[model samples]
Target: MNTAVSQQPDAGVLLELDGIGISFGGLRAVDDLSFKIRRGEIVGLIGPNGAGKTTVFNMITGVYRPTDGRIRWHGRDITGLAPHRIAEAGIRRTFQTIRLFQDMTVLENVIAGQHLKMRQSWWQGLLNTPAQRREERELVEHAMEVLQKLDLADVAHEIATSLPYGAQRRVEMARTLVAKPELIILDEPAAGLNEQESAGLNDTIRAIRDAGITVILVEHDMSVVMNVTDNIVVINFGKKIAEGKPAEIRSNPLVIEAYLGQDDEEEDDPLLNAVHDQVNA
Candidate 1:
């Protein structure tokens, strides 16, 4: 166990993944990956599927402990913290599948995220007393604030399962946001969206960053990833291929090669083409 100081070289870094690696049985899902995210920045993690992007997110959010390496948040080692402890430490995430409570009202789903911080006892709830009522009221208000931020207030009373896929995605984000995390990891946020929905998601992500939370976005849409992310870290076959600003990443040969090797028909974005031309100048 290497007990090094958790801070990154960047004075503003809020999260650092130092020498992180994880494996499943004999398969190396992620191998010796390291990166740092600055406070209030939006960073993209991109690669071919099975590049261990989701596994990285899972480890950071405490779904799995890394087979080796360190994870730090705010100068504290958090490598193997429990999921709820990670959440309490101000990190939260939404899954690739948009895991919303289907039977719950949208507001109820968001309030559930406050589970780690709830102070009332089950006995208090059963008694239906003033303190429990006050807690419930506060929880509802907090849930509503989250809904309003995501512009989902109109559907607050609706069943989460009844919403469109895009709306369901918003609810997942809302649930995460209601927890007030300093770092939010979104996995494939634009996966099922149409062009318009993807664009809307871009706007929402920017709004979230502007509200002062750092964002780590895992996405495959080059156009969206290239346009919205401040920086990108590209991985291939469970290894880091490159890390740089969006403009730099857009033209990186290794990144292009990784994407091309994975899918021959993958389209290159106009921004990437423009950046490539500039890099050659």
Candidate 2:
């Protein structure tokens, strides 16, 4: 699956997952899934538990190689590039759970995200060469600008993990943003946020898109996805069941069936009613 690509996605397309599938031992985790993201779009990949959302993330980010298909970045196949190489290729992601440096200040944690861009040799570091010092200073300067951009500059000196839960999540995002990814993948970015916090997240996501970053998210919080994403892709048992606009997916019979079983009587069904009310809210 290792490929060398040298071309562009036709027109505005940024990334394409063409018939991608992956397996764990003999069990298929994702099957024949395909999607394309145009530049500056926010798309959501969602499904019920164990529906293979994260597996698709792993494959796209090069943590796993799709046994069945190729992943293209700007029309260049990047199916089996090493994870670091993929990061170097302007793709980065944040985990479902916040992962931050407990011992480092928020600014340090974000600054560390630039590890991939560090170019000084080890010897240069040992001697504290002028070029190395200049590079380090530049990284700090760039990280500070990102912190300000993300509204975290005031807490930049605080320990990353000591911040409130929502702020910690923003720190993780700041780290990812400091990497300057053209395509950012978010896994449940609003998992534990309260209503107010989640609403703020909608704005953050849009700002990222407006800043010319394409986003793909796997989120269990339907409200966040429905409100934040430009398009939604739904999957069940590793297969796509529906892909469409929020209003369309909110009422799709296939989506309702996937969330609630097919045996529902379709009358005054509280669970079904709740799902409809919740997502549409």
Candidate 3:
């Protein structure tokens, strides 16, 4: 099932996934999905469990090459690039499960993100050369700047495992930003947050856009999507069912039926009801 969107002039497209299809054994996980992510836009990808949301993320970040497709970053073929190479090409991402160095302090976690940016060679870091020392000091300063920006400086010295769940999520986001990627893909960023915490995340996401980076997020919280996303793409049975603004997605019968069929009455998530009620309110 190929899905297509015509190119637009004003909102320049930053990422393009064309004819992307991936399968595991005999089952098709993602089928011929195509979409354009505009520069500085917040695009949400939503679907139920087993909808191939995370599989698409893996393909984009080089965790897996698509069975069939071409991925373009800034309009250049980037398919099958090594994960580190993709990171170097201005793309960074966070996982659904927080992947942080638990024993490492928050500051160290952020500093680790800059490993790619450090100019010093392995021998320099190993031998502690003056140039390496200076670069490490500079990386710390840059990491602190990121911590301050994310309001994580208060816990900068604490062990990452000591922070609350929401704070842990923030730290992961700070690490992603530390890489200074032009495009960021967030997988289920609001997964464990409460209502108020999710709302705060909405503000933080908007701040990222204001800072001139594009965000592609996969979230189950309809509230966050309605409140933050500039555009949305809905997938079910590993195929795109709808693509539009929050308002349009909510009103689309096919989208409603897709989720409603699985579990009616908002599917045991207040996030969905929050979106619907807010829309009616």
TM agreement with the true structure for every prediction:
0.90, 0.92, 0.91
Clashes in predicted model 2: 0
Model 3 C-alpha lDDT per residue in residues 1-281, reported as the tens digit of each score = 22232333334878888889998899999998988899989999987667889999999999999889888876677787889888999999998899999699999998998888879899988999999999988999989988988889989999997898998999999899988899999999998998888888998898888778899999878778888999999888788899999889878888776665676644666545544464465
lDDT of each candidate versus the true structure: 0.85, 0.86, 0.85
lDDT value, residue 50 of candidate 1: 72
**Candidate 2, poorest ten consecutive residues by summed lDDT:** 262-271
Per-residue C-alpha lDDT of model 2 across residues 1-281, encoded as one tens digit per residue: 43775566778898988999988898989999988888888999987777899999999888998899889998999988889989999999999888897799999999989898889988999999999999989999999988887789999999988888888888888899888899999998987888788888888888788777899988866777878888999988899999998889888888887877734455354334546676556
Off by over 4 Å in 3: 1-11, 263-266, 269-281
Q: Looking at candidate 2, what is the lDDT of residue 158?
A: 94
**Which whole-number lDDT from 0 to 100 does residue 5 have in model 1?**
49
State the lDDT at 242 in candidate 1. 99
**Best model per TM-score:** 2
CA shift at 102, candidate 1, in angstroms? 2.3
Error of 2 at 49 (Å): 0.9
